[model samples]
Target chain A: MRCWERPLIEIIRLSVNGDSHEIGVPSHYTLLETLRYVLGLTGSKQGCDKGDCGACTVLLDGLPTLSCILPVQEAIGRQVTTIEGLADPDGPHALQDALDLTGGAQCGFCTPGILMSAAALLNVNSSPTRQEIREALSGNLCRCTGYTKIYEAVELAARALREQRPPAEVLRS
Target chain B: MLRLHPYEYHRPRELEAALELLKEHAGDVMPIAGGTDLVPNMKHRLFAPGHLVALKGLPELHGIVERQGEIVLGAAESLSSLADHHLVRSHLPSLARAAGAIAHPMIRNQATLGGNICLDTRCTYYNQTFFWREALGFCLKKDGDVCHVVRGGTRCVAAHSADTPPILMALGAKVDTASPEGVRSVELDEFFIADGIWNTQRKPDEIVTRLRVPLPSPGLRTSYQKLRERRSVDFPLLSLALAVGLDGDDRVESIALVVAALGAKPRRIGGLETLAKGERLHDELIEEIARQAYRQSNPLDNIIVDIEWRRAMVPVFVRRAIREALARP
Candidate 1:
């Protein structure tokens, strides 16, 4: 559509996962929509379509935020980190590998958001207690695995990140 | 996928420009801070403003400062920041607990104090999707004439579910608001009205700037008890904020017990000072006060929880809250 065709269109420069992209989206589009639909970073699932669920979680300036409710324009100048940002050229991120090892993702629908929340927690607290891990991931609801394995995965990931080694080594130890 | 109706998004660097936009847009504009509540409400079609004035990170509304025996909390400060701020944790522990207790951690990262204070009243019927509400033929809180919660009732009885207002009111905080008419400070107790359609005294053109919470007295003991189904991410089924100050002789010097999530306004239990003042906060006195609170609180059917059960929990929570306050160092 042309500019005059839709006056409500806003062209926002988004910084997601260390990459900047200038995209034009409807002014009311949420960051979740802008990411999944516009940017094609669908790793962040949309669960409740509101702030109640953490499925649409992303890191806005490194803090876990509900992107489903966050306006895309609000994210224009901030560092937006999604699940895609977690892995590197070498392999899957420690959290991902740990999840696989612990059978954290049964349905795998809530994994991305869980990873984002756990990542935000581990970024600051390299050694978080089990209670702290539970508190950090409280927003995420995983009905499939009953959250025991998810907690185990975050613990393993935290250990690996602290030891500066692969999660497999940390798990074996 | 629920989506917000298209609207103009405005980011004003200064408070003046924001006020200008609010004035120009009048009823068509809303100042969005966290977008935690408003966005979901918009998705539910509760509100569809033509413009949203972004208020997050505005320098005029962003800091927690202690001045003149009061702690001034910037309205736009995120709840997590408030919960973690050393000054807040040390000086206003009840407020910290209330702020931290709201929603889950991620929501706390984005939700703001001003937003929580100005949170929209909620009801099971009113908070649902348009289809759900429409199927029920709507209610008085929004787009309908009849109230489903109270048959033949004319007033909207939607509950005020915010976690911070009860504590703030019990603490005697002041909410500062700015508009085209200049700034005004109102006691947090007077900031809410009983009408659930819009419970706040805030006008369309006004923006909450900061909250001034008087520093607690040295002998003041405070506690907050929230009754919710889950430990996190759930609005309170019932919440009580208790603050009691003891004299050197262990007699009650002052007391404020505010109960919320029952109605449009957080009701401060009357006759508390008369019953508590100059009296020892013993088991007998606590039990009497709890009975009085139970009698005073009238839990409506607005909330999805069973009204009788919720009513029963009032006294239980009151006793627990009082005990918690007394136990506080």
Candidate 2:
């Protein structure tokens, strides 16, 4: 099929991490590109630049999605949560701290995506079994850590969240 | 960074407007629900549609409703939502399992049922970056002249990778489509064509609106089994879907056995009804059914696994699926 000529760029208005932003981008631009390039939220890595890798994973309307394949126009008016959004001004999110304490992030390339996936899981089920954690993070491939530490980290985070304790405090005790 | 070629993207709030846009653009336009498949293909330059009619925002294609003894699934329903839907899990667990089994959780969260059903057939020779495909001199499915899977063959042999169609077909599902002319419903079995290049009968101007699955009768049991390389995101090397109904006497009254990912379209094994009719669930009968499935399957060397191995696994999967379906209460 031939290309249809249209406006060179379109303005997209969406809420990312509770902040609303209006950005001009190509209609075909993926959410990953808009997040990393335009908005400067580079936590979501562009691993495969395809749906195969979940390194560009982020939460769209509270569900984990592969931002690399998601068109930016589709995210219009939707709530997008990236790894950077996961942290508070006070400190890192419990999951991030748990990953750090558990050595879940060796290379740290896949950690952001894994954190989002795990965070989505915890949103629904605060206490997920190891199998559930494995299934939830199956999309995020961590080549360096071998997933054992990552699974432990998610479990640790879940426990921290359930007990209403900071991950750092839990790890210390 | 792999990027999509510049194209006009149109997101219509209403389904009617979307259909009109499709009709106006015709051959130049492609309706994209989830870009999980199409965006990657666009990156590979396999398809460069001038206009993409985004179906994501249309509220019409976004709900799972139960009406008149049928489950109506909106075409744009995300795979993750469908898998987790209570009705799907309680009634059609096989479909939920199939949807959950697709790609990964992240992809499932974005990919939709309509997109998965209309997923492009895949081959080792066809799915590649533009540079890689150019270096190898594209195959029949793309810009090439010959079929690489079968040397000297005239037709493309890419395998269908969707996990839902076979199960949907076996469960007697129908797909609804809309165009400028009107809206029509097609049985899932009749929707798929047995060619890799143009696999579905869906017209360019038509958009799949919804999938209607007739509620299976009591005593009707179903199962879906897929064999893929990995436990995560890999597409099925071979898949078997079984739907069987038992009579009051516990004899098989109706049976549908479908094998997918072995060819361009999911093939329903012929003579299954006759062979399984009035037959009791026994070792010999199951073995005979599995053998029939093995005989009916035609696997090519286009996908990842060994051709012969895939062919041989058909019976094994069929047997397992049959047992699983029969075992389910």
Per-residue lDDT of candidate 2, residues B197-294 (tens digit): 97999888888889999998998999999998889999999988999999888899999988999889999999988888998889999999988888
Off by over 4 Å in 1: A1-7
What is the per-residue lDDT of model 1 for residues B140-250, given as tens digits with 9 covering 90 to 100? 998999999999999999999999999989889999999999999999999999999999999988899999999998989898989999999999989999988898888
- Per-model TM against the reference: 0.98, 0.97
Poorest stretch of ten by lDDT in candidate 1 chain A:
A1-10
Worst 10 residues of 1 chain B by lDDT: B319-328
User: In model 2 chain A, where is the ten-residue run with the lowest total lDDT?
Assistant: A1-10
- Score residue B121 of candidate 2 by CA lDDT: 96
